[model samples]
Target: MDKLRDFLKSWPGRILLILCLSPLALLGIESYFHSGVDPNQIAQVGDASVSLNEYQSAVNNRRSEILENLEDASLLNEDVLHEQVLRGLVDRALLEQQAKKLGMTVSDDTINRLLREEAIFKDENGNFSNDLFATFLRQRGMTKDQLFAEFRNQLSLDQLNASIVGTAIYPMKAINQLIDLQLESRKVWLHRFNWQDYQQQVTVNDADVKAYYEANKKSLKSPAMVDLAYIELTPEMIKVNEVTQQEIDAQYQSFKQELGLSDDRQISQILLTGSDAKARADAIKARLDKGESFAALAKAESDDPSGESGGAIGQFNPAVFGGDAAAVEQALSGLKVNQASKPVKTQFGYQIFMVTSEGSSQVPSLASVRDEMVKRTKAYKQQTLFADKVTAINDLAADGFGIEDIASQENVPLKRIKNYQQDNNTSALSQPAVIKQAFDEFVIQDQSVTTAIDTGKSTVWVQPSRYRPAKTLSLTEATVKITQVLKQQKASALALKAAKDMAAKIKTEADINKQGISFQALGDTNRQSPLLSDKERSLAFSQPAPKNGVAAMASQTEMGATLIVGDAIKTQQQSQLSAIEKAQTAAIIRDNLGQDQLQDYLEYLRVIHKVEVNDANMASAQGR
Candidate 1:
């Protein structure tokens, strides 16, 4: 019994010691078992415990950080929130995996040093301040120990990342090739032919026209379309109770009071501190005193950012000027025109004040604003009428009234479109919504009356006049296009020959410069320039000798220059050299052309790994 009492007495002291050392003991235990713990596991990898509450807290902090960084709060949406959270979790999981694979570790000393150096945790003296650190952690909803753990995990992952990707260097040959391709430039002259110039070339004979019509029977067919007359409803269309003259006068009085003319100021200032403020201010004052122009003086000397505009602050309601109700009343009390006051200090720093003008706070007469009021009243009435009419039309349509019957009953005009198809693109019925609704199988199959379809700012009613099916192009229709193509080819050949003849006329370097026929110095540009077609760019950089010095000829297209390199230019060109090298390069090119190769690589990696997404949880987190 004596021993038991002794033990009970010691137990209290032992409990106090345990409580004092609990946090450190827990941290030590965590470090010892860290290797066996999988950070990626939401509920601890091995025997460690990652509480759901802890993960949620971290997610919320991350979300808050993102929201704080955005310039516009309205742009935040469910998709953006979901994407950010998922990305953050994925990154965390990836880092955890990487850290474990590399046997990476971070110590408490490292995290402490980082915290001390972090600007967010520093004091005015530029040293680590515990108070600041605590405040920051509190604001972010994180504890010091939790932050340190995250930092440690991050550091280990960073080391692993460096091992896998940081030290890998690209081959010099590859870099050089990329740079050379980027810098390459092509030389050519352009010749343009406008379609308008060839309008006279297009002629239609009666037989030809008939043949064309026959061949393009599908195009000749009219589209199915219907004209719509419907009423629109809007707030402006509704009538409201009339506002009386007395009410108008009251509104105007309120406006005048809100303007605060008696308290309004148009004062100028001379900054007496910082970077020649006093000198500038004095110069401005001298100008103002000399009557050299208040605007000019303000522009030259006033420190107000907008002083250039004659120190104008623009008209504002008193509430917006920091002179709220009380300040407005105080400033207005017994104020006189052109009166100046001693410098006053406010939240926006010191300022001198002057009452440029003063007037009684009285509303304008109703006669002065009657026209505006009348316009508003009429608009309201129209809106109400329009809304009622639209509702009537919708009701009629719902009750199986055809557009023709509705138009007749409404006493409105009826229009018609003939032979319309879903793919028909006539300007008359080219509205996307109209096209979609008109072509819907349900609408066409039942010949059902459709609800009014909104075409942007207006609504329309549509009915099919005719429907056409797909058909093959006829020889007669193709002939004219083929002939036009052949003619263009001939013209192009002539233009090229003329260009070549002009180039051949140049002999000496002096002549080349004198005539300003400079060979375009190649810069690093790849084959992507719309300025150069693929064939032209390829020819410009191709190898092998033709009978002539030119590898091929390059000419200008309607858009830009085209190049056709001669054997001479080909000999000087540098890209993939010899036949063997060219063949190897072509293989690499083929590899790049395989569009799905990268996607397939990613899919393979995904299949080899385990990935589980708690979509419902994610959606809930995003407020979706």
Candidate 2:
């Protein structure tokens, strides 16, 4: 406990402690500080409240998680996301209250068990990996401390549902009933009506269309829209910078030195010391260059113990050496048997090297590494270019430059999108935030260009030509839509009316054939039966089991209406939901019931606490 408390005082431990306690401890902590609700609070549940600041932080984090997982960020629905985050905070608030009331908090052992279950924290063999922990932190741009904090934070959030999971119980009878309902199979006879059959009979004039338009015109209003232009920037869009031969050659030289590539076999070294060592070694090399004997020079004036034996060293087998073996080997690499190399520096001071015998080089040829060198060079250059271009675009936008000018300078095409609206995109620029960011940054601002909107893999800047807030569109603008809707409604009414008329006259399954109704027989279909559409299957199972007669019902669909007739219903037992099988299924059902209980508990808490959510403030939070 002392160790744990001391660790908690460390930066990362403190962060983790904060993560575990935050907004939650804040749930009711503020009540002790102030009596009235804070103006920034987005929701209030009992004495607990969700502040706008906390909600915004969650939104940003959720958005980042979503964007990271998405291939295309444009598909994100901001409104749905906004509501999702808000509801989560609200539910979390309720859970926090219940957990505190029940004195339910996760224990250290429980946390450890839960952490082991999380795959991210474990390696393939299922043990906690410190390297993987560091990697996960790096990927999320977090420090070790923050990740530590996050781990505890995750446990705290999970613990919020302690009351729900612990208290929720599924009655044996209820579980059995669920199994019966879920496992029940029905024999269905499906009659699909062709829309064309009813279309020809139903006629719609201008007056009929006008009446339908007035009733549903609110939905017919044109979406909040913007006519805009934007430039999308992705790393792939940047041209790869060139790699010069000089650079490749330099890298090759480095590779050769590092690998100690050499053709020299039987080698010799003359070790020396002092600042004048290079001068002396150069003088000896000059004498050797003038055809003097290298062994004779080594014998007369070398510091190495091998000097008495003419400084001979064995072939490059990593044996004893006068100085650095790799350095000596590299120096001896270029030397012929009778020749001496220029002085090479070593920790022993300076040394001269010579090869006494010939052998094949251990070093690979230039051609062997040229392709790799080129690829590495190009990749590095491309990355730098991408970063530079993105920075330049951001700077230009900051400097109040128009998007067109910035696009032209960057040499990317400026694409235009007309009447772009939320959840309705016609062009390739689909990231749901494009319009939102555009409206938020460029719409109200006097500026023409939006700030750089980064989606991790890509960035974009939008310039709106016109902005149209959501409003009721004129009759002329919505006439075509209204006409299509009226036509569909009139046709559906006709189909249902005809199907009902036919049903009233039919008395049994035999009468169906007399009425010229042809139904395809679907045998032994369950709730998840692929043979029937969802509506068709629902109608099939919802009707009571026919004791002696047929049960029939009509429902409208896009293809027209379906006339479902049921003559049999059977429970799947012995073969499917056997006694043992039902027990196993009951376990899963119980878990689901637990989740349902959690939702119901949250709902109950909301009602009792007089929970209130400020939508206007929610919108403001979303805008941020």
Q: Best candidate per TM-score, number?
A: 2
lDDT of 1 at 606: 43
Estimated TM-score for each candidate: 0.38, 0.65
The deviation in Å at residue 416 for candidate 2 is: 1.5
Query: Model 2: how far is 213 from its true place, Å?
Result: 3.2
Q: Which stretches of candidate 1 lie over 4 Å from their true place?
A: 1-92, 185-530, 533-539, 544-548, 553-563, 566-605, 613-624
Per residue, candidate 2 scores C-alpha lDDT tens digits across 162-242 of 445656677768878877777788666677776667777777777876787788778877777777888988777777757
Q: Tens digit of lDDT per residue, candidate 1, span 1-624? A: 453244234522232222222212211111111334343434432223333343455455544555568653323443444454444444444446546756899889866765555554456677877897687668757777766665566566556544544344445467446545645553333223333344344544456645555665565433443333233223443446576544443344354456562323343332334555545445544554555655555566556775666555543244544533333333333434444333344444444444454434433333555576455545545665666767777788789787778878865556665545445467555665576666656666656666776554455566553444445446565566545544454455555555555545443323334434435534433456565556556655554334423233435455323433323321125543665665565555544544234334334434544555555554445433
Model 1 residue 599 lDDT? 34
In angstroms, how far off is 198's CA in candidate 1?
17
Give me the overall lDDT of model 2. 0.69
